[model samples]
Target: MNSVVTRRNLLKLGLIAGTSLIAPRLFAQAHTNTQEIFITNLHTGETDRVLFYDQGYYLADGLDRLAWLLRDHRRNEVGGMDPKLYHLLFSLQQRYGQQKPIQIISGYRSQATNQWLQKNSDGVAKVSQHTFGQAVDFRIPKVDTQELFDVCCSYRQGGVGRYLSSRFVHIDTAGVRHWG
Candidate 1:
């Protein structure tokens, strides 16, 4: 009996060897690069330092805790917030290269709260994305509000509201729009 080696066999072996050598590095990098979001809800006086994404997977429990933290304080309503909002905040934190907790002025407003705001405040929209769990009004401590708004605008991922007088920026997963 005789044994034979073919070019295809060598190629397959090379690929297998290469993957074996590279797979661990890829896995390590993915796990090491965890995505975190630090948030402080001003209304509720609650804070969270969440590791929401790691190893190419999102932690649902972390996200749920985030939603609870961002719940409507007045009505005690918790909306199922869009996960992208957390990712957006994470990206914003990365852009700033600062881990300071984002001060949340508003998040997950209930319909009644939104309607009340709309009726009372000229700035509030009758049909605000806040009522849909897709919006957040936030500020980063020690970061210029305008700079934060500019960075969020650069992403062009959604609407950006610069509330200079209020000293916060509002971001939403809605059609791109800007307002004071």
Candidate 2:
């Protein structure tokens, strides 16, 4: 047996095993269809349609477009959004099966913006996931927001909040919790 050949085979198996450890979702995934989402950033009044994931893989350009869209608008600062956040959005969109854009009230927030929001807003958290680019507050047009909140909660994905007055559902990757 050639030692080099054996080493090559082991390296291949190791790669396979390492890939196994990545992309394990907290929930069961049925990613058979192309994952696409239409988005509208309310603050920036910008819109983008992204085919973020397809064939069991997340596309980088699509994610980049998403992160760009999710940037803090107050100071025009961009942040690297956590990809898990996209997977959650994809799953939610899949469940709704709607073709309409996800109307975003909030996404990535700079610490300065967050601090300002905390001072001015009633429920803004000091350590919000938005600062970490791990959360989104959004609503679909013509969709019942209460029902959307219920749908977000049903997934058991992470922190889910229904702000009725604001008419948006907030989801985040930091905590497994639900709130109003």
Candidate 3:
């Protein structure tokens, strides 16, 4: 009887075990659904859907182009925004499905855009998290913007700003308690 241990056998064993370990992760990735957020434009009365996946967030199908129109600064921007905020937005959609789409007046603002906004509007915060891609300005389409502000205040995730004339509520991941 002759028996020889070879590299081929070891390779085959490693391949089988590695595939077994990664199979579940591949399955989960295939099964996961995009996070859904609905934005309602207060002035236009238009509702739109936005989807967020694991990648650097891209505009989802059926999303209002106006809501995500900040100037691109992807190359020079920070990206560690907490996923919890996206989940919170999804929860809001679930809780208020019947209402008009919650309008994303602003999301993921670029530093240049934030600077321009700060220069133009007294309402814009000097140290806004929007510049860091960690805040959003939103409102409910056809619903009173104040109602949206009230809803955001209930969550207590971060900063909440009520801008009545601007017709939007701002939510951030700053972990500070504020409303204006």
Candidate 4:
């Protein structure tokens, strides 16, 4: 039996082999580009590892869960957290070159909570960004607080507060300002 080896068949074979070889690499690249956040809320003992951004779109469900996770524990109120804040956190993770879960010391703060803290604490701001869901106090496990603070400061995107004693770094999506 003589089978004619046609150019079209050869081209099809080459294309199939090329696609087979390239598909996995493309998938891996997409996986790597996916922006994920792993967080543990210290106050509520809630944890989430979410792929919030894939390709170029932010997942609404992931954002919703993140907002719930970051809710004010005192009043159990969920605020509309700024998406930029999440992006900032994602950027921090990328900058650190690690996928460690960020331990959230604080996230959204209710007006009552903020007011009470301001009245009771010496360093708490009267008009805190946390009340507006624009700030987060967090620390990545095994990452130095100073190093994290430095990384945040380098971004110059917003506020970066270093509470060395507390072993946490405060980040915000407000105007550039910093405090200890």
Query: Roughly what TM-score does model 1 have, to 2 decimal places?
Result: 0.79
In candidate 4, which residue pairs get closer than 3 Å at backbone N, Cα or C atoms, i.e. clash?
none
Each candidate's TM vs. the true structure?
A: 0.79, 0.80, 0.58, 0.78
Give the runs in model 3 whose Cα sits over 4 Å from its true position.
1-34, 40-81
lDDT string for model 4 (13-113, tens) is: 99999999999888777655678888899888888887787876789998899999989999999998998888888887776655687889889999999
Write model 2 residue lDDT over 1-180, tens digit each, in one string.
Answer: 799999999999999887777645422256645777888899889988898878778889998899889999998898888887777777766666657788888899999999999999899999999999999999988788899988888878789999998789999988689999
Give lDDT tens digits, candidate 3, residues 1-180.
Answer: 123456767778999999999997887775365666665544335555656653334444323343343212332333444455666677677767735566666666666767788898787767768767677777655667778778788888888888898887778878857666
Off-target runs (Cα >4 Å) in candidate 4 are 1-32, 97-99
* lDDT, each prediction: 0.87, 0.85, 0.64, 0.87
Task: List, residue by residue over 1-180, the lDDT tens digit for candidate 1.
Answer: 123457778789999999999998887775556788988999888888988887678888888899898899989999989887988999888777656888999999998999888888869988889899999999998889889988899988899999998899999999987777
Off by over 4 Å in 2: 1-29
Candidate 1 lDDT at 148 equals 90
Error of 4 at 25 (Å): 21
lDDT of 4 at 22: 100
Candidate 4: lDDT of 11? 82
Q: Sort by lDDT, best first: what order? A: 1, 4, 2, 3
